[model samples]
Each structure stands twice: as C-alpha cells, then as structure tokens.
Target: MRALIAVATAATLAVASPLLAATLGDDGLHKTDWMRDTFKDLREDLAEANAEGKRLVIFFEQRGCVYCTKMHEEVFPEPVLSDYIEENYFVVQMNLHGDTEVTDLDGEALSEKAAARKWGILFTPTILFLPEEVPEGQSVSQAAVSVMPGAFALGTTLDMFTWVNEKRYELDGDEDFQRYHARMIQERDNGKTD
Candidate 1:
C-alpha cells in the first residue's frame, strides 16, 4: 500500500509539473507592458512611438496564416531579434480581419480592420517599418514607405532589421528596396560589415 501511494504521487507530480511549466512559459512570453494585442491599440501605439522618438514596427497578420504563426513563434522569440526590437521599435500586432475601433493620431475613430484594408494590407504577416511621424494633418490611408510581406528567414530578417536601424533607405535612391537588399546580401557575403 505504501509503494502504490508513492507511485501515484509521483505520477501526479510528473503531469502537474509539465502543466505548471507551460503556464509559466506562456506568462513569461506575454510579460511586456507595451505589447499591444489588438489592431486599434497598435495604431494608437504608433503615436506613442512617435512621441517617444522610437520607430514603429506594425505586424499585420490574419487568422490561419501559417507564416504569421511562424513569425510569432520563430522570429519574434529569437533572442537577438527580440533584443533589437525591444531596443529600437514599438511593436504592434494587428489582426487583418478583426473589427475594432481605432483612433488615429488626429483623434479620428475608424474601424481598425477597415483602415488596414485602405492601407493595402492584403497579405498576411506584412511588416511595416515607420521611421517618421505621420504629418499632423495627414491621413493613415497613405501607404507605408517600406513594407515587407510574407515570411522571412532569420538572416534576411536580420539584414532588413539592420538596414532600417541604420536608415539605409535614405541613401539608396531609385533602386527600390529589393535592389538595395540584394546589395546588402552581396556585401555581407563579401565579409563587409555595415
């Protein structure tokens, strides 16, 4: 009887331990004060970023988008990527199909998902890097200057991250971002560090 009781106790603890670990890990992943979970809040966060002199990185994603899940699970959790993002950007997560009210910087209330449509955010996991503030009287309907759609590998993602961090878009003119990106790849392969 004593042996049986001990075995049962051990089995219960083994199952409970995994459950406790999973809950703790989830709690840790969501333990940031500035992480916005909705599109509306994310738009508002852009203004906060502008006020704080931080760049805005808006991640537009849709339900059932495998690439979006991959980005969230793989890219965002990467230690180096997370560190860079936390240091340089105000990150915003937006659901492409959810209906929610979003207040723009100008205090206009619009459907958050509708605004995404107006901005041509048709793809899942589109990342927009906003370096400058939208002008006071300007509209959010304007297209982002830099948009990267689809999933990206860590190397490509890191390259883009560095380029945006250093403001290379200002120097590379008329070649388009893809061409500039290619140049970066070449330079990197040649052991050139920028």
Candidate 2:
C-alpha cells in the first residue's frame, strides 16, 4: 500500500506540474506548443494568421530574461490565458540577440538583432500585435497596432490581448488602451465582463 500511494502521488504531481516549465529550448527560451516556427517574414506570417483566423503576434525574448521566465512559469501557464493565446494568435518568436534572419513588412531583410534595433525593441518579452493588413512601405514597427513591452499579470495580459483582438484601437481613439484596460478591470471586478 505504501508503494502504491507513493506512485499515485508522483503521478499526480507530474500531471499537475506546469507544462511550460520543462520546454526550454537550447536557446534557453521557453517554447510553447502554440509558438509557430516560421521563416520570420512578417508579411507571410500575417497572411498565415489571417488564413487561420488568428492574429499575428511577434514575441521578442532573450537568454537569461528573468521576466520571460516569470511569464512562462506563472502567467502563460494559466489555462485561461494559454488557451486564449493558443486559439487566437499565431505567435512568432524572435531572439533579441540572435542571428536568425527576419524579413520586415517593408521588404527589409535583417538579422533578428538588427530587426530588434530597427524596431526600437529594448526589452525581452516585447510582444507586437500586428494588424490584419499592413500598409504598403510600412515596417512592422510602424504597422504594429499594439506593443506590450513587459510581463503582466493574468488580468492585464488577457485584457491586452482581448483589446487588441477586438480592434479597440481603431475606435477613433475614443478609448485608448489605458482607458480600455481600466474599464475592463472595473467590469471584471464588478463581475460584469468576461
């Protein structure tokens, strides 16, 4: 009976462990099942996302990023956020200091590091939310509808994604992200919003 109980306990703990905890790639970045391995072409990624009825999201991360680790271990592992992201976004990961080639929407080909420099990305876990269509001659930096630059808790993270997915930024600037986030928080606290 003691051996059986020990086995059961081990199985339960294994099953309950955070799935993202053990998915670190050789690059030392956390990998998720939803992260798509792509050619790093913004235009093609957007097209693919559109075809899948998903949004295009660019994630900038680097080795030894503590905030990235926090996000992977805590925020993203939450089932609600993970399920929403997996279902609605085509996420492309970019190493902030890597040499992987990337093609910008404005037809600029550059290494990942250069692209980060060009995009003015200075932090790990900078998430770019791209619009469905990019204007001609516009770079990803210029065309991105929203950019989340740091780790956030579940409520804020979900609200950010939800706001972007709903295209609230296009509403004549009536409700900016801060306002939208505030309202959403209020509603959630009141148990009146999703």
User: Which model scores highest in TM-score?
Assistant: 2
| Every model's TM-score | 0.69, 0.89
RMSD of each: 7.5, 3.0
Q: Candidate 2's residue-wise lDDT over 1-194, tens digit each? A: 99999999999998997565527899988899889999998889999999999999999999999999999888898888899999999999999999999999999999999999999999998999999999999999999999999999888899999999999988895689888888887888694543
**Tens-place lDDT digits, model 1, residues 48-167:** 787777787776666667786666666666666666777777776666775667665455676758767766788887877776656664455452557778899765787777778677
TM-score of 1: 0.69
Cα-lDDT of candidate 1:
0.65
Reference-based lDDT, each prediction = 0.65, 0.91
lDDT score of model 2?
Answer: 0.91
Candidate 1 regions with alpha-carbon error over 4 angstroms: 1-34, 37-44, 105-107, 141-143, 172-176, 187-194
List, in order, the clash count of every candidate structure: 0, 0
Q: Relative to the unseen true structure, what is the C-alpha lDDT of residue 136 in candidate 2, on a scale of 0 to 100?
A: 97
Q: Give the best candidate by lDDT.
A: 2
